[model samples]
Target: MEFLKLPKRTTGDRSYGLTSIADFGTPVGRLISILDDYSHIIDIAKMGIGSAYITPNIQQKIDLYKEYQIKPYCGGTLFEKCYQQNKITEYLAYLKKLGIEWIEVSNGTLDIPLEERLTIIERAKEDFHVIAEVGSKDCDLDMSISEWQEEIQIFLEAGCEYVITEGRDSGTSGIYEKSGQIKSELIDELIKGIDPKKIIFEAPTAKHQMFFINQIGPNVNLGNVKLDDVLTLEAQRNGLRSETFYLEEQNANYINQAPAH
Candidate 1:
């Protein structure tokens, strides 16, 4: 069946345009079905946290993502656990064994020093496509906007492919308040100092997704999206959904026309 042609958005060099989380227990068959419809819009498939440890037939799942041209990687929380266990080397080797090439490097939960985090990014860059996350998972540990911007620069300088703003799968931490409201001022400050294209915002909720797309344009990179919302998020990006329908330039004429009383 022919699908409607949508406006093309720049996705850099990534095969798929959006990033979605595939947590533990995601049915491989179901995932494949979702991809059959929306694979063109998805780029990265993150096996959230330590899900890779308990997920059944993980290699099969990873293979499927690759077959569909989606980059698959273990979540940063798993990397933190490996770091805590002093199994960093083994973890890298294991990821290699699984044929994974992309990885997330983050210190959201564990307080890894900035220097050490940069070192990790530098080393990880040697083997994998490192996507470093910036921000603390602990709500109380908020950093100033300048500090956030500086850290993002450090991570990018350290050779991370992209810097992710931490918005846990719950959409209530890191860059967001407990109520799921984005710290727009902080984001605005960061954008002023750095290139927004190099950063992926973790917008797990519908509101967060729409806000980012509106603020940064349709090509804004987003992460931690739930499996079910992939298509909906794409709709928002392409101005096919109500929340963003007016975003389409072609709709300007209709929007300015008088309505019937």
Candidate 2:
């Protein structure tokens, strides 16, 4: 079946983007069907945490993701487990064997030293496209905006393709308050200091996604999105949904306006 032609929205590869999660519970057949319809709008398919281990025919799933041009990688928690077990090298090898090139390096759970994390990013870059995440997953952990800004710079300098602002799958940690409210003051500070394009804000909830899109513009890079929300989020991005429909109207008016006198 053919799809309707729509005005192209700026994708992260072209500008900024969305990274969706593919966990163990999602059936492969269902995922493939969704990809058939929406892969053009989906950028990344993160096999969240160690879901790869529990997923049936994991390699096939990875191949399907690759086939559709979706960058697929295990979540950073799996890397943390490998690191803690002193099997990071094995993890990298396994990822390569699966034909995966994109990887995430994060320290949300473990307190890996900053220098050590940078070294990991530098090393990982030799074999893979590294996506380094900043901010702790634990809500109790408090960090200053300057600290976040500094770490983001370090990750970027160390050659991470994208730096993820930690918002756990629940969207209640990292950049959000325990109640899922964004720490806007801190986000504002980070945005002022860093290039928003390089940072992927983890906005897993609808509210969080809307807030970031509204605050950072439609092209903001967002991560940790659920698989089902891919099209919904894209609709918001392109102003197809009610929440952002005003943006579509504004653009239409701009394009149709008469020349100024």
Candidate 3:
């Protein structure tokens, strides 16, 4: 009966529908202890860049993440490192031993052949929930919409759950220009050939988050988010106090005010 208690809910009382936290091992045991308090809302917890390599305790943290219904996957950069060292099979085996059900396969740093990348994706799909990534970490390297489209298709056909468009950490590299602005026209063309649902943008900035939310809607998959920014990003998605929410409210008000016979 206690579980059946339903409080009065309202749109005004809600904001984000999904939130993901980045784990940096900042008192993670204490953090997971409090996760059940918000487990119903937090959707994921990415083991942030290379932090897993620093400690063996990560396996237990990952287990905790799953216990809270949060999918915890290694960073793409970690996969890139393993691929660079030609140790991907070893990496996959390690992930399995760690009880991880998800892994990110990316070629952000090293030049992994497209055929090889496809093979890696398929191999990862054999056991883990594979998320493939596109976009180079180097700013000088540019990927055309056509190329992005083909890569998306390749990953999707190979059973990848999502293809992350690399914005890198600073949101100034890859598909994003130096000014942190997204080339919407390029994104528009890329989306023409791929399902938006299978694409996730690495939008780590507020402006980037807002632009994507406004253009692609709140449900757009975003990545590389900092640990502390999840709540703020969720606020944007749910149209809480941000300009997007205000605009929606204004539009609703206008519609309600329109003279009706």
Candidate 2: the clashing residue pairs are 12-16
For 1-261, candidate 1 gives per-residue lDDT tens digits of: 948654455453452235665555579888878889877778888898788978879899989989888889999899999989988889899899999999888998999988887777778788999999999888878888888988999888888888999989888889999878899999878877787768989998889998877776676778998888888887887788887776655433221121211
- The pairs that clash in candidate 1 are none
Give residue 86's lDDT in candidate 3 (0 to 100). 79
Residue-by-residue lDDT tens digits, candidate 3, 1-261: 344312111222122222445666656667665675656556656777778878667767877878877778888778888887878889999899888888888888888899998888777888998888888888888888888888888888889877878887788887798778788888878766676757777777788887776666655567766666766776675566445664344333221222211
TM-score of each candidate? 0.90, 0.89, 0.83
lDDT by residue (tens digit), candidate 2, 70-166: 8899988889999899998899999999999999999999998888888877888999999999999899998898899999998888888889999
Give all candidates' CA lDDT scores: 0.80, 0.80, 0.71
Q: Stretches of candidate 1 above 4 Å error?
A: 1-7, 11-17, 250-261
Model 2 is weakest, by summed lDDT over 10 consecutive residues, at: 252-261
Error of 1 at 96 (Å): 0.4
